[model samples]
Target: AQSVAQPEDQVNVAEGNPLTVKCTYSVSGNPYLFWYVQYPNRGLQFLLKYITGDNLVKGSYGFEAEFNKSQTSFHLKKPSALVSDSALYFCAAVDNYGQNFVFGPGTRLSVLP
Candidate 1:
């Protein structure tokens, strides 16, 4: 079965500090990974995706991720986190044989000022 797991309920970070929300996925074949962010009462906004090639993928809000095949993990990262970065983060995966995607419950990133 294809699934995405976000082990953390939330990540607390101070302004200008680095922050990370954990994510791991499982699929039958190759993985098409994506990240999204959501603000209060707003639709989710796309961040990045890992389809093929380089494991290091960058996205909006100065975010990036490293796709690891062996571990089946795609962890989002940032050099420095901003207070505005506080929001809900979700990791998603497209089914190898199915077009629909599976999403993690979501990790709330709290970037304190």
Candidate 2:
């Protein structure tokens, strides 16, 4: 079984400051991790992914995630937060045998200006 965990329900960060959203996963084998963002009343948009290679992976909109195999964690990071960056973020694990992906509950980020 593959699953993802998002420990926080919401995160608050000031504009121009760095922001981080945490995630952890459990899978049968090597995991394919992904990050996605969803705006209000909108569908989720792919932010980044970690298939293989370096532990550090960068993705869209100045977002990056570090894959820690030992910890089974893939935490998302942004160098500078923006008011517009406030949204719902999700962490997902791709099933190795199928095209299905199991997503985390979600983490809402609120950026204050």
lDDT of 2 by residue, 1-113 (tens): 67899999999999999999999998767889999999999999999999989999999999999999999999999999999999999999975665558999999999999
lDDT of each: 0.91, 0.95
Residues forming the 10-long window of minimal summed lDDT in candidate 1 = 93-102
Q: Give the alpha carbon lDDT tens digit for every residue of 25-86 in model 1.
A: 98778889999999999999999999999999999979999999999999999989998898
lDDT of 2 at 98: 55
- Per lDDT, the best of the predicted structures is 2
Predicted structure 2, TM vs. truth: 0.95
Off by over 4 Å in 1: none
Clashes of 1: 0
Which residue pairs clash in candidate 1? none
